[model samples]
Target: MMGQFDKNALPVAIIGGGPVGLAAAAHLIKKGEKFIVLEAGESVGSSILEWGHVQMFSPWQYNIDQAAKELLENAGWTSPDEEALPTGRELVEKYLLPLSNLPEIKEQIMLQAKVVRVAKKAHDKLKTGKRDTVPFQLYVEANGDTTVIEAKAVIDSSGTWTNPNPMLSNGIWTNAERQLHNEIHYGIPNVVQLENRYQNKTTLVIGSGHSAINALLGLATLQQKYSDTKIYWVLRKKQIHEVYGGQENDGLAARGELGIRIQQLVESGRINILTPFHINGVYPTNDKITVVGELNGEEFTIGDIDEMVVSTGFRPDTSFLNEVRINLDSTVESIDTLAPLIDPNTLLG
Candidate 1:
C-alpha cells in the first residue's frame, strides 16, 4: 500500500534519457508537471551511442511520437525525412538531442547522474492530514559530487540495449580461452578481426536471430577482405530462410540486404549452415575446442573453432525498482498501469 502524500508539492524524476524517456519528458511538460530526467551516461541517448553503426528498422515517422513531433515543429526543429532509417548516431543527433533541447525539456535533465537507490520516505502530515511530499532519495553522482533528490514520481524508460545476453557454450571453449579473447563476444560494430582469428580456421556462430545474421554477414564481409577466413553458422532451427521475415522492413536497407546476403552465402557455399542441432556441451582439446552436439538424434563433435558470437536478445534493467514494489510482469517489464513506470511513477511506491 502506498502512503498518502501532499500531491501538490512533489516533483517528478525521470530515470534514463533514451528516446522513450525523452517522450515521457515531453508528455510531462505538456501536462505542466515538474520533473527532472536523470541519465547515467555523460549525455542523452547513451544507448544509441553504444549502437553507433546499427540503424533502427523503424522509420522516422514511427520513431517520433506525436507530442515530440509537435513540440519540435513548434520550436522550428527540422525533422528527418520519414523515409530515411536513421543510424543510431543519426537518431541521437537528428532527433533525441533536438527534442531534449526544447526549453521545457532541457531544463529538467541531469546528465551523468546515475540513480543508485530508490527508497521511500517516512514523515508526519500537517493539520491537513496529508503527509508532507514523500521524498525518493535518488543517489545521483555528477561531476564528482553526490546528491539526493526528493521527487513525487519516477519514470523508467531505460531501453534493453545496455545488457547483452550471454552465449551459452559448453566446455568446448574453455573459460581461459574466453577470457583471453573477450573481444570476440563484445558487440563492437564495423570491426573486421574475424580474419585474424579465423584465417584457415573454422568459426561457428550461434543463434538464428538478427544477431546471428549480423555475425554471419560481418564474417562474410571480413572473409571478402581477407580471403582466408572460414565461417560456419549453427542454429537449432531446421533452415536459415525460415528465420528471415519479420517486422524489420521499415526504412533501413541493411536488414533486408543482410537477409539477402545470408541466402546468398548459403547458396554459394561460403558459409556452412547447420540447423536442428542442439549443443550438448563443449570441452577444450589440444588443437581445437570440441563442440558436442546432437544432430537429428545422432551425437557428434565439432572441433577447431576460432570464435563464437552469441547475438541473443536482452532484458530490461529493473532490479533497482525491486524495493519500490512497482507491479512488474513475469519478464520484469514494467506494467503500463498509467504513466511511464520509472521516474515520477516511482513516487507512488
Candidate 2:
C-alpha cells in the first residue's frame, strides 16, 4: 500500500547532469515546474571533459538549447562565436558550465549522485492497480551511501558515452582483451598530452567513425615528430570510401571537412587501412597484442601493436529501468518508435 500524500507536489527528476539533463531543467523552469537533476559526476559535463581535446563538428549555435540560452542571456552570460567549432572542453566552459550556474538550476542539482534503480512507488512491474496515481522511487548512490528519492516523473537523459561497445567485431568481451587493458585505449586518447605512450610506437585504430578519424589524425601529427611512429586503421566497411560520409556535400562544412582531410590522409599512404576486417580473437604474445581477424574473407593476424584505440561506438545503458515498462528496438536498442528514424542502416545508406 502506498502512503497518502500530494503526488502532484513531488518534483520531476532528471538523470545525468550533462547537456541534455541541464537543458531539461531549464525547460522545466520556464514551465514553472519544480525539478531536481541528479548527476553522476563531480560536476556538470564531466564526461565531455574526458574527450575535451577533440573538437566537435557542430558549432555552438547548433548545440545550445533555446531555454538554456535564454536563461544564460538573462544572467549576463556572453555567448561564444556562433559559427566557430568548439572542442569538448570549450563546450563545457562556454555553454554547459554557464547554464548550470544559473541560480534557478544550480541549487536544484545533486552532483556525485548516481541513480542505480527506478520504479513506481509501492508497485512492481506487474502491478498496475493505482500505479498511475503513485510517484516514482529512485535509488541513488552517492558518497558511499544509498538514498531513495521520490519523483512525480523521471527523465533518463543519461547519454551513452560511458558505455562503449566492445572491440570484437561480433560484440563479445574476452579475458584476453581484458588482460591487455593496459595497452588498449577504448576511446579517443589525448595523443599530444600522452605523447610518450604513443610516440615512436606502432598504433592500431579501429572503426571509421569521427572518433577513429580523430585518433588517427592525432597519431599522424605525432608521426611527423617521430618518423618511426606507425599508424594502422581498420574498418568493417568493404570500401574505405563508404566511411567518408557526405564529404563536401554535407550541410555542415566542418563535418564534411573531416571526410576531405581523412581521404587525403588515406591517399598519402602514411597509414595502413584494412577494410572488411572481422576481429575474431585478441591474444597477448611477448608482451604485445596479436589481433586475429578475417580480412576480405581471409584469416589474418596483425601483431606487434604497441597500442590500440577502439573507437567502435557506444550503446545506451537501460539496466536501471528494468522495473519500468518501456519499449526499445531489438536491434538499434533505441526507443521503439524512434528506431526507424535513427537507425544507422537507414541513415548511412
Candidate 3:
C-alpha cells in the first residue's frame, strides 16, 4: 500500500524502528516524501523493552517528538501525562507502539529484518565515477532470506544497545569472559523479575554511569529483602562523586535525584566500593567468577559466588556502514565533526 509517492522515485530508507527512526519517518511524511523503515527487532523499540522495568528520568514532554506528536494527534491518539516520567515499557507502549501503528508508518516498517551491509548502488567505496548519481544499496536479511533494497537516502538510527562495551579496561573481549555467559549480564537486568538469580547472591556491578547506578540500586533493593545479598561497585574514577552529576543543581529534578539516591546508598555502606579499579581479566572457577584487576596502584582479585552485571555502556555498531565511507572518531565512535560537540570531556572542559 504505497502512499501518494512517485512510482519512479526511490524512497528514503530509515534503519531501526525505535523512536529516532520513527520520528524521522514522521518528518518525511510531513514533507510528502516516500520512505521505508527497516527494523532488526521483532517490534518497534525492542531494545528499550530489555530494560522495560526501569523508569526514564525525562518527563513525557521531552520524550515525545514534535513531528510524531503531530501525526499521533491527527490520528486521534490521546497524549500521555506531559509532566509524568515513564518507564521504558510505558515509552514503548504509550508512545512508540502508537506511532508505529499509524497507517502511514505501519505499511512502511519491516520488522525482524537485519541490515547486513550498505553501499552505493552500482559503485564500490573506492569507485568515484558516477557515485553521486547512484542510489544507496542495502543488503537486508529476514526469515533466512537476503534481499537488496535501493534508496535515495539512508538514516541510520540503529542505536548502541545491541553493541555493548567490554568489561576489560583495555576494551578487549576475551574467551574467559565469553565462557561465563550464563553468569554475566550486560545492561540492567530486571532484578525484581529475576529474583531467583540475584537473591542472596554476591553480584559485582562495574562502571560508574547511570546504567551501573540503576543496576546497583536494583540489587540494593533486592538486598533489603534478603539480607545476605552482596553487591560490589567498581569504578575507574578515583572519586566516586565524579559520577554523581549535578545533583540538586541539575535542571532535571528526576535525573538529579538519581545522583542523590546513589550517594545516600554509598554512605549507608551496603555496597562495597572499589574506585580506580581497572579490570584486566575475568575467570570462571568452580562455577563461580573471579575478577582480577588493579585497584589504586595495587593488584586486586575479587572472587564472586554468584552473578555479574557489566554496565560499561554501549557503542554504535557501524560494521554495516563500512562501505559507505562515513568518517567517525576513534575515541567516541561518532561522526568525526559531531563527536567533539557531544563528547562529555569536551562539554565538561
Candidate 4:
C-alpha cells in the first residue's frame, strides 16, 4: 500500500541495508522512484558478515529477490550456481557486494547513518487532518551529529537480527544477566577463529533450534582439539526428540546432518542434555555463571559454567515506531498472514 507522491519533491527513505532493504531499493528504482537507503553500519550488509562462516539452508535460486536479480543481470552481472547453497560469507562477497556496487544503488545508500526518531513533520500521533499531507521527518544521527530529513513516506526494513532474545524464560532481562554480559554470547560465533577463547571451557547452550545445534557442533569440534572443553544443552521441551527434524530425509543435506549430529552428540555424552528446563535467572558464581532454573516445574540450579550461548531466536526492534500507525501481530511480531505456526518448540519465552 504505497502512497502516491512526487519522487522529486520528497524521496522515499529506506531504513536498512540488509538484503530486504536492498531489494526494496531495487524495486523503487525499477518504478523510477526517487529514494534514499540509510544504513546504520559502516557498510551495506554489515550484519551478514557477523555469521559469514555459516552456510544457508536455501540455495542461490531462492535467495535472490526478483527485482534485485533483474537489476544485477541487466548490469552485466553473472549469477552464481542457482542450486548451490551459499555460506553467509559467499552470499555477501559474491552477491550483495556486486549489487551494492551498481551505480544506481551505490549512489542512494548512506552508511553510518542511524535514524533515532521519526514522526510526521510538525505533527504528533494525535494529529490527523493534513498529517498525511505533511512530509515525514526522520531524526538521523550520523557522524555524531543529529540531522532531520524529510521523506514522503518511509519503508522501515530494519531487520530483527541484531535484537536477540534473553536467556530467561520470561524474557525480562535482569541486572544479574546484564552483569554477566561478557560471559554470555548470542547467535553463532566463529568458534574456529576463537580457539583460545572457547578452549577448555564448559559452555551452556539454551534453545532447541538449528542455531543451538550448530553451536554444540562447533563446541564439539573445539573439544576435539582441546579435550578439556565441555558442552551443555538446555531445552524446555518435554522430549529432546522434538528437535530432530527430518534428519536424513530433509532435502538440505547439511540441515538434516545437523539434527543427526546433535542427536549423536546427546547420545554419545559429548553434549550434556537438560530438557524440560525453565530458566529463572542468571547469576555469577566465583569462577563461572550459575544458571538458576526449574526442571519441569522442579527447582534446579546448573552451576559452574564458564560460558553461555543463547539461540532462542529473534525479535524485531520497533521502539522507535511507537508513534507511527502500523499493524503488527501481537504474538509473532510479524504481519498477520505470515505469522509463524504455533512454535513447535514447547519452550515459551
Candidate 5:
C-alpha cells in the first residue's frame, strides 16, 4: 500500500499513539501530509489504560486537541460535555478508540510496535553533509521482527509513562532497589480490587502528589473494612500542607477534592503521615522489606512494610533518541527550548 505513494516522499513519523501523537497525525492529515504513528502497546491509549479507573482532574475541553476534535466532529461524532471529566477508560473508549478508527488514522497507526532506534539514513552521527535531506531511519520491533521505516521528520510524543522515577531522595538508582521491583508498584494500582492482597497488611505510600494521595485514600478505604491494615504516607516535602493544592478556590473540583479528602483522612488519624524523609535505600532484611532514610538530618529506618506504592512520577525515555540529534534538557528531560519555563514552585499550583 505504501508503494502507491510517491517513492521520493517519506511519511512523517509520530512515535506514540496516545492523545498527543494522534492529534499530531490529525494535523498532518489536515495539511495533506503523509505520516505514520507507531504505538508500543497492544492498542491506542494503552498507557492511559493503566490508570483507566482514575478520573482525570481536567475536563474534556482541556483534554481534547483541537485537530482531534474537528476530526471527530467531521465524522458525525457528538462529544461528551466539555465541562464533564472522564476517567482514563472513558477517554480511551470514547475518544481515542473513535479517533483510531478513522480511516485516515487507523491505516497509519501500528500497534505493538516498539521503536528501538532512530537515526539518519545512510549517515552516522559524525557525518554532516546533506544530513537534512536524509530521511530518519526508525528501527521498530514487533513480535520479534524488526522493520526499518524512513521518515521525512519525526514528531516524538512518546511520553514518559514507562520510565518512573525512584523514591530515593538523592535521585539515584541503587542495586538494592533493583531487586525490590516486584514488591513495589510505580503508579496507582486498583486498590479497591486488591482488598484480598492488602487486607490486614502494612503498606507504605510514597510521594506527595495526587498519585500518592489517591493510593493513600484507597488504602485508607481498605483499612475501614479491615482494621488491621495500616497505611503510611511518606514524602520528602518540608511541609504537608503544600500538597493540599487549591481547595475550595480551585477551578477544577475533582483535583481540589483530592487534597481535601486526603487532608481529612490525615486529620482523622487514619493515615500515618511522614514528611521530610530522605530515602537512603530499600533492601530485603530477613524476608521483610526495610526502608532506610533520613529525617531532620538524622538517620531513620522503617521496616515491616508488606507492600509499597510509589507515586514518585516518571521521566521521559530518550534512550532510543541517542542516535537522533535533538536538544533535550539535562534535568527535566523536556525539549531544551521549553525547559526554561518549568518552575517547581509554580508547577504544582
Candidate 6:
C-alpha cells in the first residue's frame, strides 16, 4: 500500500533498492535522516533475482557490506556457510532479504514503484537569485496509478546490472534470426538453450571474455554427449590465454582449464579455434547461418553454423540521467567524479 506523504517529511529519495541503494539507506537511517527508497521490481535485489541461477564470482565477504553485515549480525541472521560462491538467488534470499527485513530499513523501501521522471522544482521568481534549497520532484508509477514525491535530494544507484547490451553485429542479420539465435539475449544466466540448438551442428562463439569461455565450455560439454555437434571459438586476439585474468587462483585455474580444453578440441579437430579475426556479418543460407569475416587481409566465410554466441560486454544505463545536470565522463558512459560535484553531506549527484 502507498503511504501518504506530508511533502516535507522526507529530505531524500533513493531510486533503486539494490545493494548500493540499500547501503545508502542504512547510512541515512544511522544519521536519523528521513528518506524513501523506490524499487521498480517486486523486491529488492531485482537483478539478483533475475540471475538467480548464476553463481557470483565474488564471495560473501566481498559481496556484503559493513552496514548490512552489522545489521544482520545484530539481528542474529545466520549467513550461508558454503565456502563455494553463492548463487544470485542465495545472495538475495540470505543477504539482501535479511538486511532489508531490519526494522529501520524495511520501512524506508517502497517496492514495485517505478520512478519515471525526476525534475528540479522551480523556485519563486523573487527567490531565484538567493541561495535556496533545491527540491527534487520524483514522478513514480505504482499499481496502475501515478504518484509524485518531492525531496531535498535524490540518489540514483540504478546501475546497468539490469540492462544488458545486445550483440553488436552488421545489419545483415534479420531481426527474427537474431531473436531465434538468442543473439540479443544478452546477460542470460544459462547457456542450455544455445547448447541445445547447436546440437549436432557447428556453433560459432565470438569474443574473448568469460562469457565466451563459458559458452564454449558449455557447448563442449554438450558435444561430449551429443556426437554430431561441433564448436568454433573465434577471437580477435591471437590466442585464448589472453583472457584468463581472474583475481582468484581457482578462477584463473578454471579459466585456464577451459582454454586448454578448447585447445585440445582444436588439436583433436573437434572444435576450430579462429584467432586474429573479427566477424563481419551473418547471412542466412537456407537453413544455416553463414558468418563472414576477415583474417590477415584475406576475407573468409564460415558457413553452416547452427548458432552463434556473441559475448560482447554491456555499457551502463545513463541515458535517463542526461537531463538531470549530473556531469558525465566524455570517454565513458559514467558519471563524472569531479564535475557537477556530489555533496559530501548529502551524497547527491
**lDDT by residue for model 1 over 93-149, one digit each (tens)?**
999999989888888898888877675665322222223345666667888887878
- lDDT (Cα atoms) of all candidates against the true structure: 0.71, 0.92, 0.92, 0.86, 0.88, 0.69
Best by TM-score: 2
Backbone collisions counted per model: 16, 0, 0, 0, 0, 0
Q: Which 10 consecutive residues of model 5 have the lowest summed lDDT?
A: 1-10
Q: Write down the RMSD of candidate 3 (Cα, Å).
A: 3.3
Error of 1 at 228 (Å): 1.7
Report model 3's TM-score to 2 decimal places.
0.96
The clash tally of candidate 5 reads: 0
* Model 3 CA lDDT for position 65: 98
What lDDT tens digits, residue by residue, belong to model 6 across residues 184-297?
A: 234433556555566787777777766676667777778888888878777777655555553245453444555565556556666788777766766677777777777654
Pick the winner on lDDT between candidates 3 and 6. Answer: 3
Better of 2 and 3 by TM-score: 2
Residue 194 lDDT, candidate 1, scale 0-100: 34
Poorest 10 consecutive residues by lDDT, candidate 3: 1-10
Lowest summed lDDT window (length 10), candidate 6: 340-349
Better of 2 and 5 by lDDT: 2
Q: Model 4, range 83-136, lDDT digits (tens) per residue? A: 898998888888888988899999988899988888986668887866777788
- Model 1 misplaced regions, further than 4 Å: 1-5, 122-133, 144-146, 169-181, 186-188, 192-203, 246-257, 279-302, 331-349
Residue-level lDDT of model 2, residues 1-349, one tens digit each, is: 4578586699999999999999999999999999999999998999898999999999989999999999999999988999999999999989998888889999999999999999998889999988888889999999999999999999999998988888899999899988988998888999999999999999999998999999999999999999999999989999999877889898999889889889989999999999999999999999778999999999999999989999999999999999988888998888888898988998877
Q: Could you tell me every candidate's TM-score relative to the true structure?
A: 0.78, 0.97, 0.96, 0.94, 0.95, 0.77
User: In candidate 4, what residue range of length 10 has the lowest lDDT sum?
Assistant: 340-349
lDDT of 3 by residue, 199-256 (tens): 9999999999888999999999999999999999989998988889999998888889
